[model samples]
Target: MVRGAPSGDLSGKTVLVVGANVGIGLEASKHFARMQPARLIIACRSEAKGKVALAEIERETGYNGCEPWIVDLANFASVIAFADKFKREGGDLHILVMNAAIALPVYQPTIDGWETILQVNYLATSLLSLLLIPQLVAAGRKSTVPSRMVIVSSGVLYWLTPAKEIETSLKPLETLGSEEWCIPNHMQSRYSESKLLNLFFVRALTDRLRSVTPLSTIAVTPGFCYSQLRRVWYEKPTFSFVKIVLAIHERLLAWTAEQGSRQLIFAAVGGRDDEENMKGGFVSRGRLVEVADFVLSDEGHRMQDTVWNETIDILSGVSDKISPIVRDYLVVPDSSIN
Candidate 1:
C-alpha cells in the first residue's frame, strides 16, 4: 500500500507548475498550495485563466503565495521573456514541473520555425528548464536542501516503433506548412515523436544534474488521465457513444487529477531522507513500473542520447552555460508501465 506522503508540509518550499490554468496542471497547483509552499508560480498562457485558477486554489485550500505568470511555450521569445522576468522578480524556485504540452491539429511551424508540437512539448520545455537551472542550483547551494525538476512525459514513448527506427525517421520536415504532412493520421507520428523527445530530454537533464549536488531531475508519465484534452478528441457528434464508453473507461482506469499528481508530489517531496527507492523512471499509482523492456536497450539509450544532444544544442543557442548532465545511474524510462 502507498503510504500517504509525510503530510502536506512543504512549508517554505517554492514550487512552480507550468500550464497551471486547467486540468492536471491546475490540480497540481492546488495540491502544492495545500502543502503551504512558500510560493506557487502558476505558469500559463492566459493570465485571466491563471488568475481564476489561482483564486480558486487559494479559496479551496486556504493557502496563499500563489501568483500567475503568462507564458506561451509555442513562442521562443515569450519563453525567454517569462524566464527573465521570473529571474528578476520571482524568488528561488525549488521545484519546477514541466507539465505543458501540445498535440498539434496539423503540421505547423512555431515562431522559431520548428514543428509546433515539438517546439512546445520539447524545445520550449527545454528552454524554460535551462533558463531556470541556475535558480535550482543556487537554491541547492544556499539552503543545503534538495531540489527537483520533473517533466510530465507520456507512456506513448514506449508504444511506438523501435528506437533504431526513430533515428532513421528523424529528419527535416520539408513541408512544414503542409497539412498533408501533419501527424496523427500518419501513424500519430507527431504526438509519439514529441513524447519520445520528452523522455530523452528529461533523461539528458537527469544525467547533467547528477554532479550538480543536491539537485535532481526526473521524468514520468501521468498515465491516461480523463482530462479535457481527451474530450477534445470526442468532439464529433457521432462519437458521443464512443465518448461515453471511453469516459467510463477513463474513470475506471485513470485517476483524478489529484491522484495523477501523487507521484509528481512524491517526486517533489514525498520520500524520506533514507528512502532512496523512488529516484528515476515512469511512475504512476504511487508505484514505479518498468518502461517497455526495449526502452532499456542500447538503442533506447542511444535514442535518448540523440535527443539529448539535439536538446542541448537548441538550449546552448539560447544560453551558453546550459549543459546536460551525463552520468551512470540506475535510471529507468517509464516508471508507470512495468
Candidate 2:
C-alpha cells in the first residue's frame, strides 16, 4: 500500500517514537521497524504497554531490535528523569517524534499544577526536546548525514484562537466555567489553543536551529487516522454512527496509518539535499506546505519570540537539573595539566 516508503531502509539509524503505545504513534513505530533501523525506542507512558507494543512491532516487521522506554510527557520531573536516564545509559538518538499528548475531558491540572491538555500536549514536549538537545546534538555531530526533528503538529491549528489571543499570563481554566467568562460554548477550543502552541514552538525552534545546527526541523500533520484521539471529536452514540460513516469514508477518501506516515518519512529521509526544498517547514496531505495562519506572519515570529522567552523563564530549572547528570555521565580526566 501507498507504494511502501520512498526508502524504508533505515538500516543504521536510531529512531525514538514518542507515544509509541497506540494510534498513529504505534503505526509510526512499525514503520520505523520496517526500515530495519539499528534501534527503535518506543517512548511510552506505561512500561507494560510499551513492552507489548514493542513485541507487536517486532512481530509485524520482523525487526527485533525495537525496545521501549518509559516516559510520562505530562510531568516535568518525569521528563527530566527520562532524559537523565538516557544520558546515563548512553542512549544516542537520531530522530525525535513529539507525538504523545493528553486530551482533556473536563479541564484538569497536571501533577505540576498546569492545565492538563496544554501541559501535556505542548509545554512538556518543548521541555523534553530541550532537555534532550545535548544528546541530539551529539548524535548529529557523529552522524554522516543530517539528523531530523519531526514535530507532529496539527493542521487544525489554523482554525483556533487567533495569534493575538495567546495571553502571557497563565489563565485558569476555572475562569471559563463562569457565565461571565463566556467567549464561546466549546471547551474544545482550549485543545485548539495547545495545538496552536505546537506550531509556534516548532517555528521558534526552527529559527534557532537554522542558526546553530544542521539538524533540520519539520512540523507536520499526520492527516486523519482512526485513533483514541477521535474521542474528543465525537460522542458515544454519535461515535458509533461516526465510525460507520468513517469506515465507508475510508473506503472512499482516506489513507491508512502507513500511508499517512509519508510526510514524516519524507521529512526524516526523503527529498534532495536542497535547503529550500526542506527544513523549518510544515507538511500536510503528503506534501510540504506553508503553515497557513497568522503564526507564519512577521508579527507571528514576534509572537513566537515572546512566548518562547516566557516559556524559557517558566522552565528555568530544566538545564540546571541536567548539570548533575552531565557531571556523573561525563568521563572526567584524571587531572588537568598545569
Q: Which ten residues in a row have the lowest lDDT in candidate 1?
A: 324-333
lDDT of 2 by residue, 1-338 (tens): 34345565777778888888987788878878878888888899989999889888978979899879998977888888888887887466788888887665465667877766767787788778777766776777787655677778877776664423344333322333323433334444766666777777776665555344646777878766656675554555555564677567666766666666665666666654564446667877656787765775665565566676666656665457444433332233222211
Candidate 1 residue-wise lDDT, 61-115, digit = tens: 9987898989999888899898889889877778899888876445677777777
TM match of model 1 to true structure: 0.84
The candidate scoring highest on lDDT is 1
What lDDT does the true structure give each of the candidates? 0.69, 0.69
Candidate 1: pairs in clash: 207-325, 207-326, 208-324, 208-325, 282-334, 282-335, 282-336, 289-335, 290-338
Off by over 4 Å in 1: 1-6, 162-165, 169-184, 210-212, 235-248, 274-279, 318-338
CA error at residue 163 for candidate 1, angstroms: 7.3
